[model samples]
Target: MSPWTMPLVSAAVLLLTGAVLVALWLWVNRQSWTDQEKRTLAQLEVVKVASGIALGGGGLFTLYLAARRQRTQEEAQADINADAEARRITELYTKAVQQLGDDKAPVRLGGLYALERLGQQQPDQRQTIVNVLCAYLRMPYTPPPERAARSAKGVHRPLLRNSGRRAGIRRPEGQSPAAGLVDAQQERDVRLTAQRILVAHLKRGGESWGELDINLDGAVLIDFRVSDGLFRAATFRGATFIGDMYFLGIFTGFVSFAGASFVDEANFGGTFRGVTRFSEVFFGGEVAFSGVSFAGYVTSFAGASFAADAIFGETEFVGRTHFRDSAFSGRAGFASAWVGESAIEPGSSWPAGWTVSGEATSRPGRDGHDGQWFRLVRTSSAAPPRPPTARS
Candidate 1:
């Protein structure tokens, strides 16, 4: 800081102290004051009015000091923010280098999170951020083994939080535990900061770690809906099936699919909204769904593998999808599906679908889908107009 800045800061401190003292004194003097009260002492006639003048002057001086102090504090806050931003930028770059080199997916995810935190003060960095997230989304999501009977044990296996250190937050401004306590509003700010960090880390593809393992007891998270969401490699490995899981364009850092195998089906019925790459994608977890829904595209799976019961009973596909040499096991079901035929597909495929009335015995996967599933159901051109053969 400049010499001038130090002095201004010190002056601000002194003024703040003086203002506080003055406030205390004034409060004390007003202690006995009330609506029906007055200076009724018998010594009033003999009192010196100069004393009152002195008090009033002190008040004016206090006001001046307070105003000056406020100005300095504002300056200090700006300085703090600038310093924080600078340090964060430096850390972000350092982490980014480490992320690129580190073998674990989480570290790279951390780097992505750090970049986002840095971007808070640098909004124009949005495009740069897009690359980071996109890289993750392009990875892969694969399944593993097959289980005779499916259970919910591996339905949800959460990944690690890829949040960086800056996820920490300061208490609400102007809230002093000694004088002003932060209320819900203040705490909310802190809460939101943490949430942003978590969300951002997930976006950067930090959740999928090739070196680590995931274990979700039984969670079929199709929408990436749960934050701090968990998953299981065993379930994914035993995944005979996996229902529609969509990102809807959200950024993701990590999503564990370790030792997870698919038996019946797997589906990404939406758009890959942002960076969501994950390494070590495996499917051995048996999963079953009658239908699935997704609003955005899907992406990312590095070293992810899949095994059994693969079924896509009825799933919708809306964007570009690629499963670069990914594997699947057992009946990769794509029966009675109604996906949007690519604009290039024969225009006669407007599939009207339905949701599974009961827990779908299998997840749906198909070419053109519209978020619906049907059992023992079929579509026809009105049975060939009833063949009007009789001419009745």
Candidate 2:
């Protein structure tokens, strides 16, 4: 109510009371009541009316202040609770990461699981946990040398040998496997487990994490698979694939494989939905993309080299695919490959030893007239010519 409302109402009530009292006084005066007694009664009534108005207004204002104060206290308590909860989550995350640094493989595995659980429980921590896991995978580790010679192995064996020597010296016995040193087999298992965890979370649906950016630069991976998965961004720059690698993932963001080496066979049967780069990549063994699709705006393979047969049979290039200055050391097959109004320039960068299949070529004969040599033509043609039929 307005400040003047209460005062006005009180004054009206007082006037009515005074009028009634005066009428009573008139009647009483006609009787035996004295004028001084009526005056005393009127003064007492005025004092009571003033006191009631003051008390009622004061009570309402006090209640309003109390209610506001209670609300403020509740908000403050809630803020404090949120802060404490955040602190607790941070502590848990720290403990789990610390466990990953433990020397024992089992302990490290436990730490991975803990981080995984934490990420699942806290959606905000998912990307951080993923980074931690990738960092672990990116760390250097030596697999035991399969051969007697230490340098012949593909895995990191120097770290293992040093660890063993340190353990041997510390042992009370003459020489023994070092304490807290993971053996080659155990180390391999750990690496495989890490790979599995990464792949499992990247799959679609069923607790799978989406829109993750993976950076595995200079990491050593073996028999890796990214089939039927989705990623925000993926980079394997300078990475070494020890065994066969299958890259069939769908990239929604930037992707790179510059300077990456595929030691064994690699199959890039994937779909690119964004910018993609594969410059200076080396495929040591055979590589095939029989049904792959490159649909990104920019797909580059500048300076990439293929040692063995590189097949692109039936591959679809729906976007700009560049292979500028790339070397094909072996047969480069593009039989039945489709370039649907897209840009794909396979220039004359092949090595002298390289030969392209399904190309129509011609060389001069002893005769003055021009003579046809090979049945395929090599040019920067976006649309592939009709593939020659196979001989019976």
Candidate 3:
């Protein structure tokens, strides 16, 4: 049972066996001995039994000491192995980070892959590796302009869009004038690779990092799409989505896109379970929130501007919703949407002539429903004035 119990029992059995052997020898020589010899033989038998027990105990002690030494050596070896592994991970991490600073785009891409492989092999380093990728995307970058075609006269015109400093041609420190120009197209490719590395490990299925928090504040993403994924506490505040952006996933904690700008089609169809904010966000293209559920403490779209058609079809808002001073340049649709426990704050913009039904407010919490429900209804056909396009 206990660790000491077996050893103690074995020691007792060994000592008893030694005593029995000594007694049997004395009994066999009893008839062949005189009275004087009998006395001498009894004394010798006592000494023999004592010596045998002492020897047996000494052997057990030696065995225990050997076992203890072996255990200590194994523990020390394990410690050494652990230290060696830590050093290896540190070396690999340092080398990969250095690779990211290379001037060549191919070298930077290799660094990104190296970091991804490292994260996959070491789960404890995944969050740190993701932060590195996010930091890379946050670096100063200008998207490449559309390729210009040659004129009919066989002359190439100077590209005006994204010209000068915005064209990513700024000189770096200690660089020659001839090598000062940075290739925007090459930098775009490197940034795209970093974004891909983040997304590849965040989705469901093969080698996915489970529900990690992401903070991409002020980062620029190109043609980003995250579908059927789960996240905890994601932040994209002040970030810029250069192309079509899709956030069709689930957020279990705080999510913010405050002051963000979506340049192309922005679609969001997911569930937000914490405080969700889109305050002052600018949507430059068609925006949709089809079948989305906001079940957080607050869902704010205060001062947000939509340049194209905005749709909220079959969407459910289960918390406090704010649309204060939001401007939509195109048609705003709220078809089949439900709002729960939301107050119509002053200066809040809604769909034209939309009214909240009082009867629907009292019907929730009945029939196993969640909260107070508010159904939106249209009372007039007057459309809101369309605002001017936000982009220059």
Candidate 4:
């Protein structure tokens, strides 16, 4: 209560007490005191006592309610502040990535590092965002906190390789190359872009046969998603596939052909490596190759249905290979090529009498021990014992 209210209450109490005293004084001063007046004085005293108890109890209850309401409001405000902070952190992290460069490298790295903190506090949303960001950074692996910490962290570096930098150095739309020279500026831009993203993604981790199709000349590392999407036509000319390259899960709107290849060596064994699928894809342009070689567990067309000719000339498959159940509509020639392997099983049946002619092809070593698998069951005497060379 206010200071004024306290004084007023004191005055009311004093008036009540004085009135009671006056009544008592009058009784004592009276020549005769009635029983009815005595009863009225007793009732007045009981009412005053009850009023004092009720007023004190009501004041205490009101004070408790006010305190509880204040505490609840404070807690609600705290929760709101916490939510705002989380959203701000997430936004800051996204900005750091979008505007990343050498000048902003500090912010970029800080943003990635901050995820470790935010993820600790707000585990759910932070983790989801972290997973996506890590993917963009193209880090090979991203583990959860405890395990990630337990194992040594992989310092993530990014590089771009064989981006459409090959978009140049080719004959112009209506003009042929001036003799045997390339536009030097175009070549430099292409080389620089490749060196940046390539040195990180490829040179560091060393993966294979993968097509990273973003626009050329951006100088953006592999640290971002292909928001504009895959490349139109890629070139790996004079580029070595030291590691098994992969292009299976790619969704390129145009063609991807790796010509002029050094596909397989000791450290470089080409396999399906991972799942390779080119499902229902159309290649308007030809997939030309001059000297592409494959070694190791190689699977070129796995569940792939090609509408164009998989024209392989001077190409070599030196290991367990399969073009199993794949459709090659146009001509498929293994001309002047060699296959030196323990076994070569052909799965594609020629229903259209589709030609798979190898004009000057030679198998390095031929074994007759494979007779159990392909020995003749029906004799065609008219065809002259179906010569063992033909093997009916």
Per-residue lDDT over 7-110 for candidate 3, one digit per residue giving the tens place of the 0 to 100 score: 78677867776777678667756646567777677767776776777677778767877898899999999999999999999998888999899988888888
lDDT (C-alpha) at residue 386 in model 3? 46
Q: Order of all candidates by lDDT, from best down to worst?
A: 3, 2, 1, 4
Residue 168's lDDT within candidate 3 is: 68
Candidate that beats the other on lDDT, 1 or 4, i.e. the better one: 1
| TM-score, one value per model | 0.30, 0.66, 0.78, 0.29
lDDT of each: 0.39, 0.69, 0.77, 0.37
Q: State which candidate has the highest lDDT.
A: 3
Inter-residue clash pairs, candidate 3: none
- For candidate 3, the per-residue lDDT at 205 reads 79
lDDT string, candidate 2, 1-392, tens digits: 46896567656656765666566556545655468787767656655665565566566656766897898999999999999989988998998899888867788788888888888888888888888888988888655544422332333434445666767654256432332133555666777777888888887787888879889988878778877787888888888887777877677888899988888899876677778888888888899987776667777777788777888876655556667567776677865555543342343222223234443335332212233322222455333122211111
Q: Please rank every candidate by TM-score, starting with the best.
A: 3, 2, 1, 4
Return the top candidate by TM-score.
3
Q: After superposition, how far is residue 223 of candidate 3 from its true place, in Å?
A: 0.4
**Model 2, residue 344: what's the lDDT?**
29
What TM-score quantifies how close candidate 1 is to the native fold?
A: 0.30
lDDT string, candidate 1, 1-392, tens digits: 35686467556656655565566555546656553334333123213343454456567667777898899999999999989987876677667646644544455556656666655556555445534443332233222212311221233334536565345544568644322222322222322333344334434245322121222323232223223332211123222124434322222223334333333234333322222332344544433334433223443333444445545555443333233334444333545433432211222122122122222333334323434333323343221111111000
How far residue 57's Cα lies from its native spot in candidate 4, in Å, is 4.5
Quality of model 1 by C-alpha lDDT: 0.39
